[model samples]
Target: MSEVLESTTTELTPGVRVPLIGLGTWPMAGEEAAAAVSRAIANGYRHIDTAENYGNEEDVGEGIRRSGIARQDIFITTKFNRDWHSREGVLTAFERSAHRLGVDYLDLFLVHWPNPAQGRFVEACEGLRQLADDGAIRAWGVSNFKPAHLRHVLDAGLTVPVNQVQVDPARGQPDQLAFHRQHGITTGAYSPLGRNGDFMASPAITGPARELGRTPGQIVLRWHVQQGRIATPKSASDARQRQNLDVFGFELTQEQLAAINALETGGPPRLDSDTFGH
Candidate 1:
């Protein structure tokens, strides 16, 4: 069945709006990844997320072509590693990624992580800002960045249009979310559903799933977008991909929303940005 799900967007700039739900391509490679991307675009997904670290930009580009969707109609996002954390290094990285993706311009490009120990993150942000101003990219951001790291970037007078972090009902980073709110940075939730189905059994999620007649995954993804946050959920199955993007047609009650928020266990994320980055 061919179905076009309505897309919802969050504005990162005056005119740039990112689709709230995106297809995340990670750990999937070669033709399988390409096929998945093609299927997702056909299923009404306008946003696609990839990273150099994922080693699938070439496949992703192939998938885009296979989808037969106009390049301008899709919002493509990709990230670079710490090695590209400099003014010139960032440009080089963008060129390489764009070339691999077979696109001359990108919708959004990001620093995959803040390698603070290297102390070049500030310069990296500078490079991203320059790219945005010159129209090489529509917008730029950082991922896995904590409040402390963001403060330094902010102090350096750089504009962070978005910050993609690991956020889910189980590991809700209230402090990090608050910091983003204070600084006007849009929160993009990677691993937004948590590891596996571990958190799906919580009453906070299951209760709403039962009440709303939706899957636990849908419940959690709805929670993210209802709060004006963006979520990129990875699913290779056609059925699962459709389910993930079919979150916009319903509304969750205040009680249900608060119940899900109450599931926070106050634990550290599986991957801490401080010590881990490529």
Candidate 2:
């Protein structure tokens, strides 16, 4: 059995300590998803990220069971769809997701998208708060929320623990990250590595990879955790899974970090939450 890596965590709430790095399960389903989760756990990962929209919660749950790790030993995060953007609807979504994941409670639950057109995300946030207050979940957050959406949530006097977004070296979302910091909201990065291997070829990333003798992906994940952000990087290959978790052992120089940070293209994120929804 592989030794489990010691977790480095960031506080999402007063008492909630979320691992700095996690496993992302998206665009994978069925037995393949299950096996990946199982392999990840055996290789030292304690964080697993999934969503209802991904349609693989059952498989992820099966993988957890196969790993023989106690439920409490792992941190699980899942997101709900827009159709459930209501006080009661969010509760219903939680019930269904918990049932599918075979877990009595969740570590963190996020409103998948704002779906601002529906005008009920606030109520959905209300539902999430109730769940968190009642111990149904450790914490609740939003995904794909722009500054405007988060501002609305805050204006309502609601506190957001985290905001999950697509962030990579190529599209760093500096403005979004700055807002999160100002609001004391933890930034959870999805797709932390840019869409393809193309971005990894940049000298900014490659230089560090070569100097440290680590793969470009490892360098990137290291850059993420070094900044105190939470990243969920998905990989089904056992070797990749192990490699992802192995990022904790090294440090990146400020110059190298800045070089990679400079890779941001200043382009709009791939999906605009304003007009996009499940």
What TM-score, to 2 decimals, does candidate 1 have? Answer: 0.97
Write the residue-wise lDDT of candidate 2 on 113-225 in tens digits: 99999998999999999999999999999999999999889998899999999999888999999999999999999999878847799998888899999999999999898
**Considering summed lDDT, which 10 consecutive residues are worst modelled in model 2?**
1-10
Clashes of 1: 0
Query: Which ranges in model 1 have alpha carbons more than 4 Å from their true place?
Result: 1-7
Prediction 2 TM-score vs. true = 0.97
| Backbone-clash count (model 2) | 0
Clashes per candidate, residues 3 or more apart or on different chains? 0, 0
